[model samples]
Target: MAMPEYTDGVLELYEITNDESEDYPEERLKYTGLRIWYRELAVYDTTRAKLSADSVEVTYKLAIPQYKKINSKCICLIDGEQHEIYNIAHTTTKDGFKESELTLKTPAYEREVIDDTERTE
Candidate 1:
């Protein structure tokens, strides 16, 4: 079932901030708190020099909207799989980070279609 979109609902969705602020104070340099979905979370292994990690700790970049609760977990999708994330570590950059960076493995998929062209030869 799909929930109706809030037309008048005053619920503030979460979002992550990445743009650099010059006039804005450092403390107010937009931080990603909510509005982040899990599947959108990009996953990678933190390693010294290897590609994989024995234990994985995921990281997410999300946008936080002003006037919303800061303690809500967003549903994450990993390679078409769904996941729930309650706590997400926050990071900021000159250009905001995307939520697609917290998966155990990278996402990849493909589709196959049969050719329907008739051969004249």
Candidate 2:
């Protein structure tokens, strides 16, 4: 099964789709309060970053118009490895019901066990 592509870039929590089917449609515009998974940032790189799935805390608008259900744990593929986020949070925009950006603080690479058989010299 092909997985939907989700980037770690700044995301705007829109809304969740009210579908009665089992398969979640990617075309749905509704923003589900779900943690988006993405690649971890390098530990040494000290620079401004956007709100990604790895973000520990997500800052949204001050006035939360609605809330969507999200996965407590999510997997993000970086460099081909899967990384998981523990928790996710959302806030209301200070101005109004606008797109809020969430940021994550995580190590560039999430430690993973490599298979020796896959190694090549």
Candidate 3:
């Protein structure tokens, strides 16, 4: 029983990969340009209420290709909102697809550092 309502939303999948830049070699997170199915697990305000400051929680269902690499650092964007991916467990697999249970939430925003090095002696 496929629900059309749940498939209405689009999920932008992003993956973490190593950037081999000569000067700024680091892990780079970029979108794989893959669109997957996205749906909220719970629509009630209870989930949003329990969220931490500036954090929005949502669960999405998606089937990823086996060739694509996915890690904890992967990012998911839905409805112009970005989310941090947690432990991705496969719910099902068939036809070279991995159905992952991707529950995401907004990561805690880091506050700007206050430079207090100048001491008034």
Candidate 4:
């Protein structure tokens, strides 16, 4: 099968800053605006503690002049929201095309909002 057309979605990749001092140990993620051809699928569920969580699965196709490496330390920004990348699964390459399935976690604030909306409806 041919690769899916990714003209509709853009993948935003981020890098984690590791500038931490003895007194201040804080790491921040910087958005590089490096977009790629991709598609996202999300699933929302509640935990046993009644906490809401979202698992955002992204299918990203490899592009030329690769921007940044996709790893657990990276974050994906979709639709103006940030999702923490937890796992990256590489699929078998075909026709010189490579793709990866990224498992991302939704931010807490976004999850809360989704939970609230689900409750109201």
Q: What TM-score would each prediction reach against the true structure?
A: 0.23, 0.27, 0.51, 0.58
Residue ranges of candidate 4 with Cα displaced over 4 Å: 41-68, 93-96, 108-121
Candidate 2: TM-score?
0.27
- lDDT of model number 3: 0.52
Stretches > 4 Å off in candidate 3: 1-5, 18-27, 43-69, 92-98, 108-121
Sort every candidate by lDDT, greatest first: 4, 3, 2, 1
**Model 2 bad stretches (over 4 Å):** 1-67, 98-121
lDDT string, candidate 1, 1-121, tens digits: 3322223212112222333555652211122222332223333333422433533233333333222234323233323343334344444433544222222222122211112132111
In order, candidate lDDTs are: 0.30, 0.32, 0.52, 0.52
How are the candidates ranked when ordered by TM-score, highest leading?
A: 4, 3, 2, 1
Tens-place lDDT per residue, model 2, 1-121, is 3332234332222222334565753222332333333322332233223344335433221212233343323333334333343334454445444321223334344433322233222
After the best TM-score superposition of candidate 1, give how far the Cα of residue 76 lies from its true spot, in angstroms.
Answer: 1.2
Number of the top-ranking candidate, with TM-score as the measure: 4
